[model samples]
Target: MQNIGKIVVVAAAALSLAACGQQAKTETAAPPSSAAPSSTAAPATQSKGRECTADDIKTTGKFGEVPTITIPDDCDPPKKLITKDLSEGTGEGAKAGQQLKMNYLLVTWSDKQKLDSSFDRGQTFDLQLGAGKVIPGWDQGLVGIKQGGRRLLIIPPDLAYGEGGNGMKPNETLVFVTDAVAVTAA
Candidate 1:
């Protein structure tokens, strides 16, 4: 079973590589289990090529379910990180050094492409806050998120993968809708 899991991981990596048309460097690795969903189909809404703001991005879903994220066709990427809590959660906020179990949907700001989603996999991604386990945007933006809350993060290149972008476009700004399912001490 472990071998099967490894095979699946390898196959998923290969598919991601093929989709991006290049090999991803180690420094650009995304969160664990960052596989693309079976379907890469475009969203039902077409972009009207309007400038996007934090308000332009929309999300609809209940906590613990996969969220639907809609991004405009094109937008000027923010120069700094922007974090907004769409729905506030109860209990203590997540802190650095704690483990966060989250469901997230990642999209690019440039072309509004869906890059990765934890909801599609029917699993939550666990990572230690500020542990360097993931990108800087996640490390910085995800702090203080309470359980059951949904947060929107608009990350510029510097806070994200920078020039590498892992399998993503170079210097791509990333839009993430993250649902904080749980938080525990690491």
Candidate 2:
């Protein structure tokens, strides 16, 4: 009878240890940041309680080159998605299910800092339009962009990463300057 009691205690202890190990593994397996910035750029000051406008963002540099984007110190971010064409393309516009090759620069609205740039890496990002592979903003905003066109997209948190912004603050907005390099229809 004593041996039976000892066996029961041992089984309970083993189950407890196994549960703890599973919990530790689950905690350590959290998803990694998706938009890890390559550059250690400084963060921008908080906005002055105003919404961001197109005038507050300035982009300079020729098409197909790395652009220099300037955001004002007091600039605030808007709540909706905004897409502005910097340079219009000459050919047919891109459609859904089409594969697109683009060079892009990404910046966080709250920090006004560059997060990533395909131009800096000297490679174009390839993705299919209207696909769920990317954020909702990119899937919606990149449609109808012509090949060789340059565009600026201001994405709100709902359209971006939402509460899990990864490398950025929670619910942070994003700014992107995208240059369409090539397109292949599906």
Candidate 3:
């Protein structure tokens, strides 16, 4: 019975390969379970494609059909920063070893929600930037802004969440209104 089963499998394999336009030199290699042979190799991926627009990004896009990702213009409430003469922090704005006191509000691109906030709570956090401790976007976004300056950051998922986005939801783009008020380096 086993031998019979093997023969049937081999026959199926040979037939599938032939259907795929693949030719086998040795009849012995024609097994029923053999993968279908293909005359054409898989298409190569393009290195550069059309440039992406704001519409292409999504916060819930990663949720797969279950959740929809959307980024609206009002995600962060469009507002130009008021001019402040504070010199942009230079030469390692926030010391690598230091902690920073910052006020921020993070919102999801889709159905904008206040995922997190520091100022809303009348509190501030001591963030250690570039310590692989904070989100990559935060580490990089907070780089040049001065301690007393406020800035807005539009972080793509690649820099913010990569693949698996914020807990519960898939990685999604985030918008932040951040103000740096202090930095303390030990």
- Prediction 2 TM-score vs. true: 0.73
Per-candidate count of clashing residue pairs (backbone under 3 Å): 0, 0, 5
lDDT of 3 by residue, 1-186 (tens): 010001111222323433211232111112222332233432333433343343333433110112222444433322221122222542346655566666555555544665554444455545565554455556666666667655556665445443331121233455655667676664
RMSD of each: 8.6, 15.8, 21.2
User: Which of candidates 1 and 3 is the stronger one according to TM-score?
Assistant: 1
**What are the per-residue Cα lDDT tens digits for candidate 2 across 1-186?**
011001111211222332211233111101212233234433555658888787678998767989978777775688888898999886888888988877778777676777666677576666667655556677778888998899888888676655532344566677888899997787
**Which window of 10 residues has the lowest lDDT sum in candidate 1?**
1-10
Highest lDDT: give the candidate number: 1
Model 1 lDDT tens row, 83-181: 889999999989889988777777777677676666776766666677765667777888899998999998876666554324555566778888898
TM-score of each prediction: 0.72, 0.73, 0.50
lDDT of 3: 0.41
Candidate 1, pairs of clashing residues:
none
Better of 2 and 3 by TM-score: 2
